[model samples]
Target: AAVPWPEVYGAGGDSPGGAGRPTRGAGALVVVQDGRLLAHLTRGGRSVLLFSRPTMGDEDGPGATDPADVQAVVTVLSSLISVGRLSPVTVEKVNGTEVMSLGAGTRAWTEAGARFTPKGLVVR
Candidate 1:
């Protein structure tokens, strides 16, 4: 099923200077599986895949915890980033915590426990 981008990140307005203008931000591609975040892919920036089990109420079921599922999500996101399908996302500090603005009224905090690996970043 193709999840609509606007459903994940609220509808965004046009960039200043019309449709051809590019917005500024650390562009990224967020991947989710079974209602749980699987990975966050940033071009030329930090990228991370989930390695720990999601907390209660964070996922629809248990499938997202599987290694195969994680790998699949990472592979898809990596391909998208490499193909230049990444979207602009804003990063800012709020109350000493780094927050990533996904779109209008949508924001996520920076994961603090992520570690770099040969493949990319893994967040526990």
Candidate 2:
């Protein structure tokens, strides 16, 4: 897919103002017949990664997210959960907390990337 120019592109005389308003790209939404699937690559693209790992010689497969990052993620999520700081909490009428956010954009780039989604989604 062709990338839409960043919002800064308008200030540089590329966009016609609103069209140039910075966007984070298609909002990472994937359209499907039944519902809007969370941002993820097609199943066909990710299937190869299930049973295969690549080397310098392999060009057909996607690379995996580094395992070394697991500790970092666990530590952050644990601390956030324990402290109830997953979302912001600065408001007089409505208090919010720090909520961790993740997306499947990484999976789109590599089959080996872990795809994340929100839990407890009740599909009616």
Candidate 3:
């Protein structure tokens, strides 16, 4: 699935100006398989892959997860981090689960209706 650039960068549309401004590159691309969500954000022919670690027991329960929902959450977060709207503090593995700590400088997450807790990201 392809997520539009406007959706990733908000109404500002990733430029100094407003919506009428032309964006530089294509939007984000997302793929979901085996209970994992992988989002690719491309710019200037370069692509960054953001993979969400599969939740516990997701493999055991087939179709328990919704790709669209996961795509929405991961794409937004990944895009924000990729474009420097959000800063990542650290990435560490906790009990085999990847944990990313982000800086508190930006309220973009909150504006996007998502928040990070001690456990993980919560999207409303």
Candidate 4:
């Protein structure tokens, strides 16, 4: 399957302007699909990843929303930052809590409360 770039770079494949803007060539791609959260850090076309469980049929349970699933997502997201794939800077909002844009125009405080629809990770 192909990576969903539209969802990754927001609706129009453009990163919103700010410190959150992903570095042009080397960036992290985080995807929520098939009941799993797939995060990869790419540099110079090479990619490395961290995923939440396996999205393989009935072998694995449902989507990436359970407490365990959410935790896995958080871990991988933090890894992105720790690895320098993402910047630590972000706009503070929601009671002074900081929100960072995780490439593809998606903003997340943490992976804790993420919910995905058929279209992709719900942003709002």
The best candidate by lDDT is 3
Stretches of model 2 off by over 4 angstroms after superposition: 1-63, 87-124
lDDT string for model 2 (25-108, tens) is: 432212222332212212211111111122233222222223233223323334553687443211110001011111221332
Give one digit per residue, the lDDT tens place, for model 4 in 61-103: 2121133544555555556657886543222211111123233
**What is the TM-score (0 to 1) of candidate 4?**
0.27
Tens-digit per-residue lDDT, 31-115, candidate 1: 6667765544444334332333432444322222344444565455446546776432222211111223222111122123223
Model 4 weakest 10-residue run by lDDT: 89-98
What is the C-alpha RMSD, rounded to one decimal, of candidate 4? 12.2
lDDT of 4 at 93: 18
Give the poorly placed runs of model 3, Cα more than 4 Å off.
1-100
User: Candidate 4: lDDT of 87?
Assistant: 48
Q: Which is the better candidate, 1 or 2, if ranked by TM-score?
A: 1
Could you arrange the candidates by lDDT from highest to lowest? 3, 1, 4, 2
Q: In candidate 3, what residue range of length 10 has the lowest lDDT sum?
A: 89-98
List the candidate numbers ranked by TM-score, top first.
1, 4, 3, 2
Q: List the residue pairs that clash in candidate 2.
A: 86-98, 86-99, 87-97, 87-98, 87-99, 88-96, 88-97, 88-98
Instruction: Point out the higher-scoring one by TM-score: 1 or 3.
Output: 1
The C-alpha TM-scores of every prediction are 0.31, 0.23, 0.23, 0.27
